[model samples]
Target: MSYVSSVFQRIKVRNANEPEFLQAVEEVFKSLEPVLEKHPEYISANILERITEPERQIIFRVSWVDDQGVLQINRGFRIQFNGALGPYKGGLRFHPSVYIGIIKFLGFEQIFKNALTGLPIGSGKGGSDFDPKGKSDGEVMRFCQSFMTELYRHIGPDVDVPAGDIGVGGREIGYLYGQYRRIKGVFENGVLTGKGLSYGGSLVRTQATGYGLIYFVDEMLKHNNKVLQGKTVVISGSGNVAIYACQKATALGAKVIAMSDSNGYIYDENGIDLPLVRQLKEVERKRIRSYLNFHPEAQYIEGCKNIWSIKCDIALPCATQNDISLENAKTLVANGVIAVGEGANMPCTNEAINYFLENKILLAPAKAANAGGVATSALEMSQNSMRYYWTFEEIETKLKNIMVTIHSNAAAASSEYGFGYNLVAGANIAGFKKVADAMMAQGNY
Candidate 1:
């Protein structure tokens, strides 16, 4: 434990201002103590030190013209954290909150998330501090073009592959992929995972994360001698992940009663209308409050956090990081939340996570729980490489198998490490072993 604590102390000193990054390192490092105790070679080889550092970091200026013919500037980053297992693979988030700490934290978490999928992808993440919310189509395209102009040099089909996240969706991916094609002048469809279907995109890529989450939760419930059917669910975030999770949970016989956006949440005692949610958030791009216009019986609250207070059999935090604070954790526990599957990266705070684990609440950590998006992206990469397409049923089957396997591996790891069903440690440890072995076999750089 001294070595782990010492390495973390140095990380704290070196990355003093990078709290997000430090939190990521601390979380994984805590899980690694048992691994280190069992395998002394890992400690002697300084794997912890090297694994924590990114393989490459790129920050560039993105300048584009706005609708008013004004010059806009934004900062972009691509942290190629590691590529030992395979090419660097992760998402590019476009939001005002993106910074080095956020990108690094996400990239570090991506290492384990990708590994837990039992895929060949390494880990990386990219994004810009640009708010693309109100931007016109032309403006968004210009921004994406500008962002890709510099990013293209560092990525390729067998290199770093960036997918969509947060503010970057099909619209953003299409723009980015178009820009990459324009600059490269080649059909490197494998370079990007979230492309349009006509251009080597997978069928279920959009719904993969959300659907995969439910599948993983199903496995977990089955393992625990329970069933997802007849369960009441509450999910935060009305984005792609949340909407799809709600849809999948409903399809699997669970009633998703509440869902939220940043502005507020909607509670429908009779279970949420998934089609209506998709219409409002996806097609119409309206807020969750707009749900009330369609169904007057449903309640709409003003804040996103209060959605956790509603009693539910399960909670899925599909929103942003640290969304479930200690207070929210207490509320969920009090209201009898039996399990929580994180559909977002680091959705729960450390304190909140500790509370859940200590209370013996079934918890699915984000890295393991929300890895479906990237896993399906890797599948898309395989399809692109083979110049073939898979049917929706075929892809869904693959995704289900992968999720079930991930749950099995994580549970086994937790049991082996004396953590029982503590999936947080299990996922981190399982993922770390794969990448650590790869790093060791490849030798130090």
Candidate 2:
């Protein structure tokens, strides 16, 4: 067997129950055959084995009291996957779906995603099983305090820095940072990336991922002698990533017709009202179905998955992992989706990705396409370290430049390997080579 296949077999056996992690590993390994063929020493040095395993896995019990005065216990985890480039960096997701396997999957993906940005940050992921959906502010704050009390010890400004994901956002980051400050008694702003502007938060951080996804897509289109202008875009999810993707795409002259939430999706043929989306989501924290209250002319779909059936020039699945199934991919291709960009990590399943590739749909993989968030997070870290901030225009420009570079690099790598613009393989090869070289240079830890 080839080295890549051999290593992946072992990973599957060891992580048999971890389907998400297994899927992530398999996706990455599939693209690594070319790399392994060229660098046989990597196999001898066991770089894949070491890189596949996390440097540290932290699991802790978080005990807190709810608003009803009842004590609640939740599990927290932090998988520091790799740090060859720099400190362990990723996000803390606070959903009930969070588990060891999910954290491992996210952390594993982060290793490459961070590397694609060409940033001096490694990959790690953390989260708790605590669902903050219906929790009161007091309850959430108490839970964050307890969670951070354990997490703070394992992270530092120059160590492992975490931002936000799924359930963790500006509010959660504030609570976590406040607790970390209370514990450490120091103004270590660089320890967190998604803080509020009143504190040390960087401008354009919230819009980075979404804006970055669109920017990368724009670059992909430009490479194919196309542009986002006049394109009909359908983006899944109405959170930070989706919201800003809509904003940026609309600004770039694409008509964003649809956006979604966990509950359902909203379709506005006249293009999504960016301000109203911001109002409904960011301000009111309401369901996407509530969008109809203002834009009565718009259609409200009851199921989010059905949003993929809408015909559009571009499809961006920014919701969650494995959101786009094979059926969704078929529907998109049948409806003539010219391009698909993963705004969420592993949003497209392996089958879905294959269908897209087989149909010759232009695809921007998540690692290279949606890397804007972490890239901006790294920018935030730099500003925090310098105790200074850049203007929104300046930060956005830097983010655009980075996304363009990532797209070009992935395209170049794909062309070099004769993949004919297979960004999936290109991104994997590009990101893995960097981490692999760094690991080799550092020797065995």
Candidate 3:
């Protein structure tokens, strides 16, 4: 067997129970065949083996009191996958779906996603199986404090910095930060990102991922002799990424037709009402079905996956991993999708991604497209280190530039490898090359 194939087999056998991690590893490995062929040094150094194994896998018990004063215990994980480029940097997801396999998969993907940002951050991911939904504010605070009490010892500003993901957001970050500060007895804002603006948070960090997804999509479409203007967009998920992507796409002259939550999706033929969406998901924290209360003319679907059936010029999947199946991909192609930007991590299945690329749909891979949040998080780290912050416009301008550079670098790598428009390979190669070289320079760990 070839070196890539041999290494992949070993990983699959070793992580047989970790289906999500295996899927992530297999996808990146498929793209790295061409890369490994060009750089025999990578093979000789055993970079693949070392990169596949995390530097440290930390699992701990988080014990907290519920509102009823009953003791609740949850499992927490922190997999510092790789730190060759810089300090380990990723996010902490707080959802019931979180587990070691999920954290490993996310951390593995972060290795490339952070590399694609061209920033001085490495890869790590942490979270718990603790569901934040349906919990009282006091219960959430207690959980966050208990989670951080164990997590703070394993992380620092220049060690392993974590931001928000999925269920963990500004409120969770705030609660965690408070606990970390209380324990350390020192102000160390750099240990976390996604903080409220009053507490050394970057101005545009909240909207970074969604806005950056649009920025990358705009550049990708522009290179393909197309524009987002007059395009109909269907964006899944009603979280931060989806909301801001809608705002920016609408600003860029695209009509966003559909957005969703886990419960359901709302389709508006008159394009999405941005303000109403923001109010519903952000302020009200309600299900997407609530949209029908204000706009009776719009249609509400029962399942979130069915959002892809809507006809649109661009499809942005901002939901969770494996959200789009091959059937969804086929439906999108039949409906005339010209571009698909991923605003969430691994939002598309490998099969779905292949179908999109096969049909020449301009695809912005998740690692390259959804990197805005982390890139801005790294910027937050820089500001915290210097004790200074930039204005919103300054941060937004820097973010747009980074997304454009990522696109140029991915496209250039694709063209160089003779992969043409296959940005999946391009992004993987570009990110892997940097991390592989850094690992080589640093020697074996």
* lDDT of each residue in 275-381, candidate 1, tens digit only: 99999888888888999998999999999999999999999999999999999999999999999999999999998999999998889899999999999999999
Tens digits of per-residue lDDT for model 3, 1-445: 9889999999988999998898888888988877778888999999999999999999999999998889999999999999998999999999988989999999999999999999999999999999988899999999999999999999998899999999999999999999999999999999999999889899889999999999999999999899999999999999999999999999999999999999889999999998999998888888989999999999999999999999999999998999989999999999898999989889899999989988999999999999999999999999999999899999999999999999999999888877987778889989999999999999878
How much lDDT does candidate 1 score?
A: 0.93
TM-scores for all candidates: the values are 0.99, 0.99, 0.99
lDDT string, candidate 2, 1-445, tens digits: 8767888899888888899999998888888777877888888789888988999999999999998889999999999999999999999999999999999999999999999999899999999999999888899999999999999999997899999999999999999999999999999999999999999999999999999999999999999999999999999998999999999898999999999999889999998888998998888888888889999999998989999999999999999999899999999999999999999989999999899999999999998899999999999999998989899999999999999999988988888877888999899989999999999999888
Model 2 stretches with alpha carbons more than 4 Å out: none
Q: What is the lDDT of residue 34 in candidate 3?
A: 74
The window of 10 residues in a row where model 3 has the poorest summed lDDT is 30-39
RMSD of each: 0.8, 0.9, 0.7
Candidate 2 local lDDT, residue 70: 92
